[model samples]
Every structure is written in C-alpha cells, then in structure tokens.
Target: MRLSATSLEQVPPGIARYSYHRAAQDIGIVHFGLGAFHRAHQAWYTDLCMDSGERGWAISGVSLRSPTVAEQLNPQDGLYTLTERSGGESTTRVIGAVREVLVATEERETIIARLGSPGVSVVSFTVTEKGYARRTGGSLDLAAAEASFYPLLTDGLRLRRERDLPGLTLLSCDNLPANGRELERLFGEWLTERAPDLAAWVAAECAFPSTMVDRIVPATTPSDIDALENLLGVRDEGAIFTERFSQWVIEDRFAGPRPRWERHGAQLVRDVAPYETAKLRMLNGAHSALAYCGLELGHEFVHQAIGDPMLRGLIERLMRQEAATSLAPAAGQDLEAYADALLARFADPALNHRLIQIAMDGSQKVPQRWLETLAYHQRYGEPCPALIEAIVAWLRHVRGDRRPVDDPMAAQLAALWATEGSSGIAAALFGPQGLFSHVWRADEASLARLTRRLG
Candidate 1:
C-alpha cells in the first residue's frame, strides 16, 4: 500500500493523522523553495490550522530550481508523512495542506498567474540565503539578480499589479538577519529600475514581514524511508524526518489577510530583530561551527560531535561567552537556558543532522553565522577564540584540505586557495573579496590567537 488519499485508511493505527476534505478550500498561499524545512514547518503549521477547521491557506508549493519535490509529492495527491522524533519517542502525521506542487521549469506562466490571484493573500519563501543574490554589503548583485528568485518574484508581482488584485504579504522565511527588510530592499531595487510605478505600489501596499523559523530537518535517506514504511505499512517517497522541536516567529505586519498562524503556536510580534538576532547568532552560529569543526574532526553526524564532552564544552563557551555577548538582551528570553536547550537539540540522536549537510553553502552561511559575531568582537576589542577555530576549519573545508566542498563560491575559493598555498591561505581567506571581508585581519593579537589555536 502507498500513502495516498485512497490509502489513508491503511496508515497504521494510533498515529495522529487527518485528511484534508474541504472541497471549497482554495489556494491562499504560494511558497517558493518547496524543500524539507518548509514542508516540515510552515506547511505543517497550516495543516494544523486546517485540522482545527480553519479554512483557506491551502499551499501551492513552487520549486524554482528542479522538479524533484513535485516528482515526489504530486503522485501521492500532495500527501506526505512527517515523522517528528524526540529522544526515543516518535509520532507520524500525514500532511495535506499542500494542495499542489508546481515547478518553474514546467509551469512558469501558471505560477505567475497564481501569484496574481486575489485568493493568494501570502507569498512566502524559504529560498535559502543564496537565492536572494545579496552581496556582503547588503546590496543586490544585479548580474546574479536576473538569474535568481527576485526576478521571478518581481514578474509575479507585476502580474498581480496589472490584474489590480489586492497586494499580498511578501514573507521571507530564510535565515538571514532582517530577512523581511532584505526582501523589501531586494524587490524594491528591482522594481524601481524596471517599473517605477510598481515599485511605488509595492512600497505602499505589499508587506515583507521578517520571520524566524527554527527546526532541525535532516536530508532523508533510504534507511529513513524504509523505517517510515515499516511504521505505516506503506511506501512514501515524500516522507521527511525531523526533530520534534519547531518554532516560527513573525514580525506582525501583513498587507492583507494571512493564516492565523498564531492560532497554531506561531509568535506574532511587533519587532522580530531581537529574537532573530539571538537565535541566528546562538543557534545558527553554533550549528555552523559544529559543521566546519566537526567535519574537520571526522565526525559525520551532529549528535556524534555534540555528544563529545570536549566539543560540547567548546560550543557552550562559543554560545554563552562569545556569541551571546553580541546580542541585545531580548525581553522574556533566558539566554543561558536557550543555549543549554540548543545543546540538547543538537545532541538529539534520532535525527542524523549531518555535518556536511550544514556545511554546504559555507560561503553563503558564514557571513551571518560566524563573521557577524566576530566583527562585533573585533569592534569591541574582545577576543573570539571559538569562532576563529570555526573559521579556520571553514578555510580548510573550502580549500578541500579535509573534505569535498559544496559551495557556490567553491570554484573561486579553490582557485584563490591554490594560488595562495598554505602560507597565504589565511590572508586570502580574510581578504577584501573573501567571505570574511568584514572580519578583522590586521589585529595582530587576534591573528596570533587564531594561528595558535588553529595549530
């Protein structure tokens, strides 16, 4: 048996599952980057809302790059299982909020048409940071912009404007700091050059609310699929396994209607920067450090690395003493408690959060996760020993000294590393055009500490 609408009755017993039987439900949300995280987090939340008898918000997921996700879920009638594991306990739920999956390569016109629909009150995206085509200086890369998601999104918005439909909320669910404002600037710049009238309309009408989404979603392997099948007595190609923990914090500003995500545990706040900053620097920063350092240390999974007392100790100091110093005290937040909880989450053995998986797109991830905090320390004349170690490991990883690199800037970085050799790699890494351009390279004391620690 396969897990589809027809086979819902056979989805094992005792699992908390539901079916989307609302015939009048329309697509009220369009999402870009239909990856595992979006499926596990946003779509799951919308599913919960529907389970509570909330109508609308059925998602039409779009893939900007390939058709792999569409290939996986469309056959099963947009149905897939989410297995949330915590410690030794696990629960499976079949998600039905995803009404359809469309690929840009196959249905660009349909995507544009749907975006212009009055029914779609939200245009949300989980397109990774690299998809934004943002430079280190927070400026859009004009050449790369044309080939990125921004252009596609602008086209959709243009269609909406021409159709005279109500402007939708442009929600950015990526990990970049001030992600909503970044999208606002990105779309604003593109529109100003192409269509000035649309730019003014977007500025006056559309809302780009910043969001903080936290979940540990690992890449699904064949073993995971087999295990899920054994549990449900059905094969589900679209199944995803994730940690039981999840969070969604949104800046409470929307142009039009949105799913009452607050009804289902999402935080809607006036300012998301404080929460965003704390989570990015502490949680995301530690994850990047673990990825680079753990990969260098030959640890495959996050649990394997975090389980080690020594590595865990290093991470603790990084979070509490180093990264936390740069963040403003968020109201009602226990920074130390959050740090401890992060370690527990990282040490969750059930979800195999691979180091290499987190390590991919290092060029895109480092600036926000590691360099931002390091820059703060340098500005204050303080030392950041743990962050330095992570940077050294990243330099090694990008240079292919330890493992295969999977970054978009891999070719450029490899060429620089090869030209510079061991003696010059450090300088090249912190150079003007490198990923760590904002990091201090002239501070002799910090450089010495980095050298001593790296040695």
Candidate 2:
C-alpha cells in the first residue's frame, strides 16, 4: 500500500500524522518549484498551521519544468513523509499541507485559474537562484524572460486584475540577498517590458516580503525511501529527509492575511535583513566554503567536511570571523551564537548533506555567499583570506575532472579557464566583463592576493 489519504491510519503510532480536515481545505497558496527544500521548509510550516485548525491555506504546488515531482506527489495524493534526523535518533511525520501539484507545462490553464482566484492571496516561490533566469548583474535576462516564471506570474496577475481581484503577496523564499526586493525588481522589469499597464496596480496592491528560511534538507536517497516504508508500514514516493532545526524569518509586509507561522516557530519581524545577512554570510557562506574546499579534500558530505580539522577550522573561522565581521547585526542578534548553532547543524552526521549538492550552482551562489564578503573586506582593507581561499577553491572546482561543473554559467566559465591562463583566471573572472552578478571585482591588490594562491 502507498501512503495516501487511504493509508493515513496505517502509519506507525510513534510517527506524527496530521489530523486536518482535508475535505474542507482550500488551495489558497500557489508555490513554484515544489522541490524537497520547499516540502521540508515552507510546506511543513503550513502543514503545522493546518493541524492547528487554520483553514483555506492548503498549497497548490507547481513544478515548473519537470513532471517528476508531480508524478511522485500526485499519485500519493500529495502525501509525503518528512524525517528529521539528529544524533542517531530520527522522527517521521507525514505532511498534508500540499493539496495537489500541477506541472506547469501540462496544467498551465488550471494553474493560471488558481493564481487568479481571490482566495489565492499568496503566490510564493522557492525557485532556486537560477530560476529567475538572470544575468550576472542580477537583472532578468530579457531574452530568456518569456520562458521564465515571471511571465507566467504576469499572466496570473493579469487575470486577477481583469477579474477585479486584489493583488496577492508575492513571497520569495529563496536564498538570495533581499530576495523579496530582488524578486520584485526582476519581475518589475519583466512586467514593465511585457505588460506595461499592470505594473502600477501590482505596485500599489501586492506585497513582496523578504524572508529568511533555514533548513538542511538533504536529497532523499532510495535507501531513505525504503526506510520510510518500513517506518510507515507503506511506501511514500515523495519522502524527504531533513535536519531537526528549521527557522523562518519573514518581513511583516503581507498584503492581507497569511498563516500564523509565527505561532509555530517562525519569526515575523520588521526587517529580515539582519537575519538574512547572518544566514547568507555565516551559514550559507560557510556552506559554499565547505562545498568547494571539501570537494578538494576528497570529502563527500557536510559532516565529513566538518570532521576534517583543516576544513572545520577554515569554516569556523570563515563564519565567526570573516562572515560575522562583515555583518551589521540588529539589536539582540548574537552572530556568534548563530555561528555556533550553524557549526553544530553542519556537523550533524545524520543529515548526509552532500558537498556536491551545495556545490551545484556555483555561479549563482558565490556572489551572495562569498563575493560580497570579499567586497566588504576590500572596502575596509580587512583580510578575509578564508573567503578568498574559498573563491580559489571554487575556481578550481569549476575546472575539475571528477564531475561536470553543475552551474548555469558552466560553459562560459569553462571557456574562460580554457582560454585564459590560470594565473590570470582570478583577474579574468573579476575583470571588467566578469561573469558574476556582483558589481565589485578584485582590485590590483586583491587580484595579486587571489592570483598568488592560484596557478
């Protein structure tokens, strides 16, 4: 038997199961990129709200390019198991917040209808950094704009406007800096170019709240699925595994009502900048450092990397010193404690967080994770050799033989390395036409520092 509405009762007694009235549920949220991280993070938070008697906020997840997620989820009646593992103990829970998943290619009209519904006041996104289809300088690649999600979002909002419906809160739950603002800017440019008139209405009514979401959802393996079957007494095709720790900090700028996510461990605040910066720099920055450096040292997983004294030392110093020092923490924010917690989370052996997984999108990740910190040091004449070393490692990673460099700019980066001398690779990538979103590049002094360490 597969885990579904029918198999709900068969789940083991020790495992948690939602008792929400699915029949009365309304799919008000339309989340894009229904990936494992979304399932583990945002969808799980909404699931908790449902258990606590919240109504009308069930998610209608949209998998943009692939039907694979839809196939895995829809068959199981949008049912999936989430396992939170810590130390050696694990907890299993069935998530019921997602009502259905729509593959965009197949169900475009239906998705547009849902998006235009007044009841769907929230259209959230967890599309990875690459999903925006952006250029190196953070603007939408206008040529690719038609195929990107923003145009689809424009169609949805246009329908809503035509039907005299109010605008929805456009929440961006990605790891980009000021993600909400970037999302708005990117979409604004796209909308202005495509649907010039709808821009003003969207500007006045819609809300794009910045959010900081934290969770380590490792890619589920076949063994994980088998383990879940043994624990649940049934198979669950959409099973996801994650760490015990999860946090969401959203800017309180909703256009209307939203889940009382704050009641269930989420933090609603005036500004998410401080929290987001800390996470991006200390947590995400160190993550990239670990990814690139760990791969160089023959480490496979996060725990393995952290277990290596040399890797751990570099990351710890990177987080607490290089990354932490760059941030202007808000009142009551303890960056050191945050760094300590991150270190602990990274060291959790149960997560099985792959270095290559974190390393996948180097071109999109490094600007926010490593380059900004480097830029900050450049401004202050401070030394962040830790970050520079990470950048160098990433440069080497982009030219590796073990696996394909899994980045959007892989071809361009490979070409840069193939044509440019390695010693000049640092200068070439940070030069006037550098293929990065960051405005800052290495000066002569910084270039010398980076070049001396590389080929």
Candidate 3:
C-alpha cells in the first residue's frame, strides 16, 4: 500500500515520519514561501523540536504565489522527505514538521486569518530576495513596490489590522544582508504610504528579527524522488534534496513567544549583524562571483565550476581577498576556515545547485554581497581585481553574448549595458543612482578597467 500521511503512526526507520492527524494538532509557527531551502533548514529544525516532544514549534507552510506547491504537497498530505547528501553517503529523513500546506492564492483570507491567529507566535518568510520588491541600496523598490505591497496590504496586513492582532515576530530567511532591517524599512515605507496608524502600531508591536540562514537545497527532481523510493523503500513525491551542512543564526529580538530553536542547533545571539556580514560576504559573495564568472567560463552547475582547477582557484583567491578584508571581527568568525569549508561545500558533487539558480537576481544581490565588499576595499585603498573581474563577468553575462540565459535582471542590465562606452561599464554599474549609490561614487579608472575587461 502507498504510504499516506494518514497512514503514518511512528517515525519511519530512515525518515522522520508523522501522521496527518498528529501534525494537524500541533501549531505555533507559520512559514511563508514553502520552498526546498525552508523545508531543508527551518522545517528541519522544527522537526528536531517535534522529535524532542517540544511544543509551540510545529509549522504551517504557506505559499503566496503558486497553487502548484500546495497541490503537490497537499496530496502527499504535507509529508515530505529531506535527503541530506555528503561526501559519498546520503541520509533520508521524512520531515513532518509542517502540519498544513495552505495556498494563499486560493484562500488569501484564510492565510491572513491564520497569520492573525493568537496561536501563531512567529511569521517567518523565505520568499527569496525579489519577493521583498527591494532595490539595491537596501531600500524598498518603489517602482516595483506594488508586486508585494498589494498582497500584503490587502490580504495579510489589512486582516491583521482589522482583527487587532497582538504582536508577533517577523523573521525573514532571504539571502539579503540585514534582512530584518530591510523588511522593517519596506514595511515602514508601505505603511507610511498606505496606513500610517497601523504602521506605527506594527512598529511598536512587531519584531523583525534579523537572521542568517545557509543551506543548499536545489529544486526537487524526479530522479530525487526515485532515489528516495529506492533507498528508503517509501514513495515521497515531495522530497527535497540538499547538502549536509545547515546553519541558522538569529538575533534574539522576538517580542512574542518563539521556538527554542537553539535546542535544535540554531544559535540565538544578541546581534546577528556580524554573522550576517560574514556569511553574506564570504559565502554569498563567492557564490555570486562563481555564478557569473564560472558560468561565463562555460559551466552549467556550481559543482562543475568547483571541479575546474582554474575556476576553483579563482573562487578561492577572490574569497580570500574580498571576504577576508570585508568581514568585521565582531562577526565572531574565522575567515580562512570559513572560506575553506565553503570551497568543500561547493565541491559537493552530489548536490546539484545549478549556476542559473545562483545567477538569478544579480541586480538585487550584487550590491549587498559583492559590491559592498568591493566598495569597502576601494575605501581602504586596496586592489579588488578579482572582485572587479567578477563584476565585469556579470556585466558581460548581462549583455547576453556570454551566457545566453534569461534572468530577471536581463532587461534592466541590458539597458545599463547599452550606456557603456569608452567611459566604462563600471561607471554604468556604479553610476546608477538606483543600485550602488550608497557604496560607490563611480571612479573613472575603475570604470576604465571594467571597460577594458569587457572589451
């Protein structure tokens, strides 16, 4: 018989399993954007809590954009497998931390109602960088503001206001640096424009806890599902595949009740800025560098790029140069060791995090992860040749001659590329008040170097 969520009683041998009925009874957290990464990381932590018989950490997965995820997960009765691959061995665990899957598209009111519920202590988001509708300077993208504001205002925030809901913690799990502050700014901006009174109420009542989350969970494929069935003797159509390493560092700014996530290996700190800077500059910056530069060198996936001796060397050098200088001591980090571990993680052949996946939203990502470090080096009178080269690669990739792939930033970057001249592409990237105003003032020689590299 096919294993259904209802059929689950005890935890399965290879996979952590639970019955649908049992999951339904547990509640405390509501997570937005129920993607693979969230499942592999946050939900995994919650699963640890559930196994320990802890209360107030069970999650309700919510999807804002697509009905497809809800459809796929609900049929499995919200039961999914999390496969962790390291060196040569793989471990499969069925995560039943998610009690329910709700499609906000079909039932927007229902989602808002759930968010407004007194029982829901935390509202966490993993909606990616673009989901915030933010621009480069860590400000709300007023031009693209409606994409997020409309849904949040009408469906989520409005309901919260109407119901006079109590304060709750808002945790953002996107890759953006200072994610908490960014959300605060966005929410503040949206509210000031639409509902000033409620905005003040939110400012006083809610907590936007900044967090640093890291893991590589690629989109699930049929082969992954097949592997789950063959290895664990169970059919899990909604299985998620990821690397073995995971980390979550949270700033303890919660106004309401929160999971003792620390119990499940999550670190609760007084401030997460140092950790955020370390991860963003060292890990995310290097990833962006590899994504553009390695893709330009004719690679399809991150593991493939790491396998190449020359590109691998380039990645290591860039990380050592850029990240080492950018990370602050307060981040409580070891730059060298972190870089070494990053290289090994990227080289994990079993995890297929594609180049295209990392290459997405370069316009939104580069400012925080790469450009900020470059600007820091510039201010200190240091050479950022490798970092500059990565920017050039990004500019070339955006020009559509090198990668030939479609990215969300393609059109905007193409427009920027058209303005490139003997003056330089660096000028174009930095001169734009929209993206890099806070960091760079557009140096002539740097622009010249960028132009020369592109030529």
lDDT per model vs. reference: 0.85, 0.89, 0.76
RMSD of 1: 1.7
User: How many pairs of residues collide in each model?
Assistant: 0, 1, 2
Query: 264 in model 2: Cα distance from truth in Å?
Result: 0.2
Error of 1 at 39 (Å): 0.7
Residues 270-319 of candidate 3: C-alpha lDDT, one tens digit per residue: 88888888888888888888888788888878889888898787788788
Question: In model 1, which regions exceed 4 Å deviation?
Answer: 431-435, 439-442, 451-455
Tens-digit lDDT track of model 2 for 1-455: 88888888888788888888887999889999999999999999999998999999999999888998999989889999898999999988989999999988888899999999878999999889998888887778988766657767888999999999989999999999999999989888988898899999999989999999999999999998987788789999899999989999999999988988998999999999999999998899998999999999999999999999998889988998888998899999999899889889999999999999999988888888888887888798887878888988999889755577889888888888888867878877886566652556777877787788875
Candidate 1 lowest-lDDT run of ten: 433-442
Instruction: List runs of model 3 lying over 4 Å from the truth.
Output: 1-3, 7-12, 18-24, 153-165, 402-406, 419-424, 432-435
Worst 10 residues of 3 by lDDT: 16-25
Instruction: Give the clashing pairs for model 2.
Output: 136-437
| 412: Cα error in model 3, Å | 1.8
TM-score of 3: 0.92
Model 1 agreement with the true structure over 1-455: per-residue lDDT tens digits:
66778887887677677655745678999999989999999999999988888788899999987899998998888889999998898889988898889998789888888888888989999989888887756777887777666666777888888888778899999998999998998878877776677788788879999999999999999999998888888889999899988899999999998888899889999989878988888999999999888877889999999987778888998999998889887689889889989999999898989999999998888888888788888888888888888887887788876667898889988998789775566666664454466654436665555555545
Residue 78, model 1, lDDT: 86
